[model samples]
Target: MGRGGGRGGGGGRLAFVVAMVVMTEMTWGLGDVHTSVATVAQLVEAEHAVIFALKDYVRKEESRLETIKRYIWGWQDGRADYVHNPINSYHFLRRLTHDFDSVRRALHHEDLTQALRANITSLRGGVEAAAEADVNGAAYSLVRLQDTYNLTVDELVEGDIRGTKAVQELSADDCFRLGQQSFNNLEFDLSDKWYQKGLELMEAKQPITHEEQLRIKRIKQQQEHRILMRQLVTNMAKQSDGQMLDRFSGLGIPISFQRQIYAQHKDVAQVEQLDDYYRRLCRGEQLQPPEAFVGLKCSYVFGKGGYRWLMPLKVELRWDDPLILVYHDVLSEAETELVKRISTPRLATTMVHSFTTHQARRSLARVGKTAWVRRGDDRTTDRILQRVEDMTGLATDTSEDFHVLNYGIGGHYDAHVDFFDLDEKSLDKSPHQGDRLATVLFYLNDVEAGGSTVFPMLGVEVPARRGSALFWFNMKRSGKGDYRTLHAACPVLLGEKWIANLWIHEWGQELRWPCTRDPED
Candidate 1:
């Protein structure tokens, strides 16, 4: 299972594609059958929907292709350095690259159904690999992908925004805040739109302050720079096909490189440079850092945690937040499949009790479902848990039951701490162990779009990777919930996100990691 094979032809994806096609055909046919004509706003709405839906997939396709191209060109390090499937990563990447090309072609077609079908077809290899590697999780993500694709198709065919509330309802501050958020997400067009809209909203409302005027001026200059930079990217991709050029335009490259050379035209030296550039971009390094660090004690350097367990593969240190280690193929395809299999049957919609409502409610902020895999309940999971304990140097019984979460579109947790507040009541009062001291998140599958575990205060965002683990301490050196750990699960814009969380308690591990009584440790 460790060695990758050709993409297996599975009935799972084909069946799903057929079902979605039929479902969407019926849903969208209603508009065409009727005499009602769609307004311009409807068309714009449909386009925006597609843009939001495909943003993540576009990000993934480019990132994976760049990574694979580097490896093929002998620039990338060993395979175990990143969290990826051993059985089908290369083949899946190859398939994704081709699929991306197909999508670009489909976008040119007049009939969007053709494009939607093409989009579903592109996922064939990925679906196969995902199903082969993680059965329950693969099915979960496939359904989510299909649903979003179908929705986009339906919107394109029959959807309308004519009757919806106008943008006039938004205040200047609302528009301003939204613009900032879009800018942070790298949606440049949307950011500019909101910024402009805020300026418009300012007219009927309060007078524009000096700061607001300066901000609007700066944003105008920045937007102009972005346009110039985009044009620079266009001139560089001289040899690329229209489809490939479209991708490069979206990649958000720096404008400083003035010369024109398509990606294919790069020499060995240029290839290395571009490889480094793409890697940094994919890791969110291009994202602007906040003005000040929130609650962070200090910056960290990457290194091993000095654990006793010996990993046969070359252990990689991908991050420095509390010794983040990524051991590839640590969980085999079979192991991942078994874990998902056990957890899926008991999956339940997670609920949070809001103090404002005083009632348990499902939140729009998060839509991920969860299930627990108790320790020693199954053979594969037992071994996995033992491995986890050894890896963390935590006592065998100190960790909580394995928590599997599935986050779909519009699913996110707003910026919040993971550790429970003693004084404040929790939303979901799940039966769990002591205060969470540390955590190890096993990224079950690579998300297609927007499922970054973002720590806004710390200015850190870790993309989820299959067969990889991200470990971090929830508490500071003084044994309190680190506000620096204030984080959120960004909304899944494109594909579903599957992850398993391992929470270690403060009940044990005195010998391994002793607590500090001092408040300012």
Candidate 2:
């Protein structure tokens, strides 16, 4: 997958892309999605969640250490490196990174509720534990959002994301922690910016240590070195190949430069540009439209199907090239609730198809849970399929089961197409359902903040509106993938996001959505 938030096509050659994508996923197992906050609602409850999560871990560790002390006394009768083992070292690092930092903030918080403050005593005995990976993932999520959306650290501290504000703003301590984590992650620019913000905020309230001051200075020095190296590389790139080698002969410049260029090449410099547009679209910025789609308008249209006369679909032309349309009130409140109720019990952590391994695996690129709600699962789903057929004038028989998804904290699906263009072998393994011809995504709930579905190529953002459905063609009339439809789900930054996707296949749509030699269609 591309770090810009999209599933990269399968092929072992895209391994470099995997490295950048996997960095956001998790170092260990699939991370705890609940621990990360993508929206303002999650941010308001963050401190409370962090407190309860860390309490039990601290209590248990204390007990375990007491037991170890007794054992050490009985065995060695002296102190040694009792906590030197891998497990102890691991937990110790977790203490510094997760537990201690969280607890410190909780202790110093001025806005903690009376009930939560009272529970602080019980935390002295026992509480809950959050995973280490979850902690790191949560910290990095803010950094990811900042980078993707081009949000300022000040905006983040104020909890003002694109004019959507949270009840609580991040504190100076929070800024410091973000900076510390960014430094650990080697994001020097972000680390320096966050550190500067923290220092500015902390100056009047608390004294920063001399060591901390020195650390910031060291970070500045590192930044200078990095910029210098980049300039040198750029200058070297302009030199003739033979001259470049001769100028820096014994310095191993050729080998090092080749490695650097190769790394940059495989990471998809163009994909990075695609991501820039993707982020801008998600931020609801307007991009220059293709000349053909200059003045598209919203209108009501009834298809040529038998059900067309019953009611006209409220269609908003999102993108003319790929024929993206948004249908209003396609689902009812009752049907939406019923679908969610059926899916709730069946929901499990969703997985992305690994391009290299050709298997589904958990990834932060997609953070949420999904349930396969088949057509016959209930009358509601069956009715939904009928409605889909009515709206698109396509056969329902070849469509896949409804994929009901509920996003958790920081939930999102990176940019990807619904069609499995790279999985041709597996496509044959199953009954010939054919490639995904079109998709109808039914929004089950209204999002308070983020969670807009964005198309990077076309600069389109369709916000989630309950009962509304967004429809788009994934394959052209020629049965080839239409890359213009490449889209992604922006991370939910506030209230819950619930959606159901119905992917209509090409097999039975041939008669309805007939093929054409004109690929552009």
Candidate 3:
């Protein structure tokens, strides 16, 4: 999830099944979570705006990340070490070790915010001076610093489309796309309406092409498939009286995602095997290690920098897109239990917002409850935040309250971006706390199956592990959202999944790491 500010803004389960049925019908990643649907769909259909606005925004942000990488590469002491390593790979992690002491020093003083600001100021001066002296070297050294500095801003843009009065909205193709998405989500009635509308638009313009005819035929077939799926789900829900989802754990297929995946990847047979294996794992059946985990020995544990923060000594699991780090046992068992106990009473099913009105509502896209673990004056609570501060090196005061999430069987979150989008500075709709810069997530408990944090874009799956933390950036330095960060929380197939989230914000980091306009190397 992206960061949220105090901009405190802020759903149910048969009602939930129905919603999941709708989500199941949409194209997997396009509509994504409900929050961005209206905004993104609007972008796609809003005429000429589609070509330059959405696509260019994405391209520029991606290019910016690449340029920063090159700049930092010049700063590196040894470029040879990274010859075979992609910027997003684990080998690039070597560059991050150098920043540990510098970032930690900011934490040494009592006023963390000021200390960090001072350190960043000093460091920026040094870098700029070096840039003047050696030009390329300033850009080449310590890439982790560049990456961390940029990603530190959380959800900078909310992509709020509210009150967009003068712009053209939802075009014909947009309706068709939404239709396809709804079809994937299993909202047949809604999907059909959208498709029919698109068909009408096409007929109005000219005669339908043979391919268009085929599209209509395929959609009808998909509608039939949805009918079958609805029957199965309704029957299962009836049989168990909605009390036992565990039984369906063995069904091992992307029931809601089938049509959507079929449309995009067009490989139903391959999906079946994948679905079966995933389900088997969810059902708690043991299997041989996959290629990714082969020869993996993540047994060794070590510490680094001043905090000597605990992290897995192995580099078995890593990814770049938005740079993810999965560190095991970062939190002790007692620490985990302590936070859980404090948060149990506060748990409530998670909710999404109406982008325009900012009203809280529930939907199937996210099927869990969340509560905050505030930075209280209590020693344990304060220490928990302190540990988080040490882990991330950002001032806690500038960040949002710690969020504790709980997931039971069937709980899941769909693909979504964590950053908010801001444009023209006229849209004052960003969250009060500021955009999320980076996300620090600690897995408080292990699941018997499922509950893996899956990054679809980066092809990374990190299963929940007790006391382990998964850290990643939500935004790039320019504060633009990183599309590559799109991720989902897979349905909890077995035991409960517990996690803690700390959203470090751009507002807080501004004082520490100021932004620069020229992102080019």
Candidate 4:
């Protein structure tokens, strides 16, 4: 009986061995088995321990790949850092580590078939998820997958997971190329866009770590510097034009008169000296004691005594040493008469009150005093206005309206635009049917210390002179508008300053009074 039992056991063993061999062969033929039969059989002897080990390895690898896929999807969707959590291998590694532990436990239990199945399913699911995520705008998962694959392949090729240094160098080179392209296009806006893209690519590189973050920061700094330089160039060009205008034609007036005007205003000279002193201070020069009352004084007057009205004013004395550009003031004799006529006390009161109450009949009234002196029409305003008109045969008609405003120190007019839309009833009672043409401001008195008409848009400052006026236009000949007419009167620093303003309206056949086109025959 014992002999029979032994032979039966041997037969059973042989049968089991044969069945295992056939299964292995079939699996190998189907390319499902990664290990040789000998190796499989070796593990199988201990209840399929070898197969379990093989399954464990595959499962861990699949989980790692899955983790990589997730990271790539995150990056591509521009959400890798959306929540302040960067998509990186470490993130994948955390998931991979957990999956690896599970595989290890299954392998230790000798569940070879189940472990292998889990690994394959996990890998397939990860790939599918990666594909879906990409379609939905997630790219970080794919990037993670590729990185992991490369690392695994490297391990397979060289028995190490870390990739070659060349991979890092290549990535850096690509980033450098992108940065260069942005810098060269002079498209600072676009360059910033590309530089950010390059930064992500550099950060995505695996195994090869460098000072990529620092390098990216440096690149951004360089881009900012380029933008600032471009702005500086533009500003310099504008300043150059202004300087040219200031020098040759005395900003439209003769150079001699400009010089004389500057000489007469001692306060202007002192303010200029102060500006120079400040500039020197910026350059670390020993500062000299500043004079008393160096800057402008601004104020506003709501009303006084029976005239309950609002009139804003500013006064500032412009220094003369580095004389800024002053544009031409042009006016016509007829226009001048119109200005003087309006300066009468009754007219001035009516016009000022009308403007304050928003009852001015004409847009021109909104701009000038009823009686403005036509300084620009006289020889004293600027020689260039006549020269330009004569050379271009522009058929110029210039004029000025003078108003004597007495405001004490610390008076200022808030910044405001001079152009009033003819269509806006709130601006003037009887709005001009045509566009505003030009403006001429005559400085009727040299302010004691401060009183300069400032055009912030043009960055031009006009100092007050006893008879000189500053001129500009609000409209172009083509009917286009200009933003240059926006101006402000800075604060009065020391004493009172009187000014004459002139606003020219578009020419039409309609005269203020009934007159024939050819005048009296």
* Candidate that scores best on lDDT: 2
Supply the TM-score for candidate 2.
0.62
Model 2 misplaced stretches (Cα beyond 4 Å): 1-132, 162-168, 180-188, 199-204, 207-269, 289-295, 304-308, 422-432, 516-521
- Candidate 2 RMSD to the real structure: 21.5
Q: Per-residue error at 151 for model 3, in Å?
A: 38
Q: Return the top candidate by TM-score.
A: 2
Q: Candidate 3: where is the Cα deviation over 4 Å?
A: 1-317, 354-358, 424-432, 511-514, 518-521
Q: For candidate 2, write residues 80-197 as lDDT tens digits.
A: 2212221122223344455555454443322333465467556754533446665555555576567666788988887665665543456666676677666554455787788778
| lDDT, ranked from best to worst | 2, 3, 1, 4
Quick one: how many clashes does candidate 1 have?
3
lDDT per model vs. reference: 0.53, 0.67, 0.54, 0.40
lDDT of 3 by residue, 1-521 (tens): 01211111111222333344455447465545457777556534543443443454456445544544554553545433232221211122323433333443323322424655576568757332221212111112111111212211011111111111111223355455546554544455555666666666656665778987787677668657767876785555544532354322322223444444344445766545544444444334444436654443444433335445344233334664456877766678998888899898889868865344446667555667899888772467787666665555666666677788997534666566666655433343334366777888889998765678876555567789998888888877776767777776766543578998887777767766566665420
Which of 2 and 3 is the better model by TM-score? 2
In terms of lDDT, model 1 sits at 0.53
